[model samples]
Target: MDKIKIDIMYLFGASGHGKVIAEIAETCGIVIDGFIDCDDNKKSVLGYPVFKELPSTTESLVVAIGDNGIRKKIVDNNIDAKYPIIIHKMSTVSKRTLLGAGTVIMAGATINVDVNIGQQCIINTNASVDHDCLIEDYVHLSPNVALAGNVTIGEGTHVGIGVCIIQGIRIGKWCTIGAGAVIIRDIPDGCTVVGNPGKIIRKMND
Candidate 1:
């Protein structure tokens, strides 16, 4: 992706996930201007002022929300906003890896060679994405989740914390892989998977 020259950076969402994104920006030596939150009750985050609207000046923004659907919604609503790729200083990303705009790679995360991660996705703290993995838009690889080589995670899927997927497995769109589940085979779209060797427990409504 092309480099985004940000004069100032602001994070959208002022909660726990937003705090972590703020630290990632600070670790990267980027100063956060403030946080933009919809909640009027949130006066500030991490000592930075919280505003209800985006500043008029040219600035980059990162959607700091954790939910895949909501992140996608925010990105869609702000189509003209500049969304930069935010990678934590401690994360290891390959030179050949292709990360889309607004994707955040958190501290201790490792994205191996030939990985293609789409926009507004979150490779959360300590997540491991092995080589040749294709993670679609708005997906969330939660902390400590592991993916074997050649894994393809479809759009809007949330791979829960500590979940493990074997090589060459294709997880379908909008699926929810529950925490600590072990995926051994392909998962269908809109399914909610759980347990070891992950079994589809239910299908989510469209």
Candidate 2:
């Protein structure tokens, strides 16, 4: 059988996250060119060569790092040239879901019916976005994050890992939710929330 031509990409990190991204890419029929990382010791991961510099032949990049703050930084550094692919071969995204450009959906992520995901958003591993969820531009839903039905997440909002957002909650734009936060009520724009039941621990300082 003739091999299918696919988008060539390199994952930015070579840890567990990188392997997960590579697996997703494989499932999506994408060709992984290599893995790139600053750590020199990661010369090879899962049989793919490690690259300290960007791959000259590849056009797409996948930021496989899990940390949101660090991931943002990595994205900012790499996005100067290469286009990043938002891959989610195992994701159950509805036909009604609107996925924006430059978004990356990793494996096991579920974008339910009528979910609106904005541009440059990162829907990471095992995250579930329920029906009628509105995710604005540049939002990052970390691993294991769950949003119930009818949740509205504003632009540039970063929902931390293992967060659980209840149904019908309207999270304002640019909010930062800490890990394991359980959002039960409506949160205003620009708030930084943490802990169970999600208190406004830090207001918009900037």
Candidate 3:
């Protein structure tokens, strides 16, 4: 069977994680256009050209950067959204797993065997997402954010860098977790949580 070909551009990352993004693209039978990186010393990675400027193309792009803030910054650029790309291959998704377009799964970010991750989610560097998890659209699992088995996450939620969610906990939509927060309970919708054990410090203005 012949696979459909798609062109994907990766931005805001280089080195090992970027290579993983490329690897997933290759595994999915997609072609990588190149990379856009902020690193000055890296002109290219694994033979793919790196640029300071994002090229004017409608082809979909995956933000492979590890930092949550940088990833958000890179995504702020306005671009045509007609062609959405998916970078997946090494992902251990079950047949039931549902992933939307323009998502980037970094190396060692596990989606479990039957997890459902939504569109444009950033399964960031070294994050461990366990089995049967349900992650909604635009969620950012920051670097090292660990979700135990069966966790249910709301849409557009930002799990902070190194935040740990216990098994089966439900995190509300558009919630923000501070760096290193440990989530042991359900968080209400539209809130910001922080500290060793996460607590809602302020409600979201929206």
Candidate 4:
């Protein structure tokens, strides 16, 4: 039998998160060329070589790091490389939804109609974003998160696992919503909110 050849894309980061993203790519039947990481000592990830520099031959890249700031920074630096939007085969995304480049919609996630998800975002396993929600760039929606209709999550925010945001809530940029918290009102930028009816536990220093 003739060898089946597949075009492979490059992945950035070689940590645990990178391994997860590579698995997702595999689930989608996409082949990964290898990892392009800054760490010289890191040799391989999931059997694929970790290259200090991305090969010129590969045209596409995926920023797999979980940190919002780092993900944004990497994408900003590699704007010339093609960033493919990756959606798990099991995830249900509406036809009307607009997903930006390098976003990963993980398995069992459900994105309702007219949702706008920005670049390099992570919609993790079993998360649900309801109708008309706006998820900005580099946002991380952790596993099992539920966002009600019309919720607007700002850029670079991290919504923790099992959190629920009520309808019409606006979470500001660079904020952190702690695990299992229920967001009932607007959260200001750079604040960390936690507990039921989420309250600002602390505001991040600029």
Pick the lDDT winner. Answer: 1
Clashes in candidate 4: how many? 0
Per-residue alpha-carbon lDDT of candidate 3 for residues 103-149, written as tens digits (9 for 90 to 100): 77765666667888876687877788888999987788888888999
* CA lDDT of every candidate: 0.92, 0.81, 0.74, 0.91
168-204: candidate 2 lDDT, tens digit per residue: 9999988899999999999988899999889998777
Instruction: Please report the TM-score between candidate 1 and the true structure.
Output: 0.94
Error of 2 at 60 (Å): 1.6
Model 4, range 57-148, lDDT digits (tens) per residue? 87789998999999988888878888988888899999999999999999999999999999999999999999999999999999999999
Give model 3's TM-score versus the native structure: 0.68
Steric clash count of candidate 1: 0
- Please identify model 2 stretches exceeding 4 Å from their true place: 1-4, 69-86
> What is the RMSD of candidate 2?
2.9
Q: Distance from true position, residue 204, model 4, in Å?
A: 4.0
The segments of candidate 1 whose C-alpha lies over 4 angstroms from its true place after superposition are 1-5
Backbone steric clashes in candidate 2, count: 1
By lDDT rank, best first, the candidates go 1, 4, 2, 3
Error of 1 at 177 (Å): 0.4
For model 4, what is the error of residue 116's alpha carbon versus the real structure, in angstroms, after optimal superposition? Answer: 0.6
TM, every model? 0.94, 0.80, 0.68, 0.93
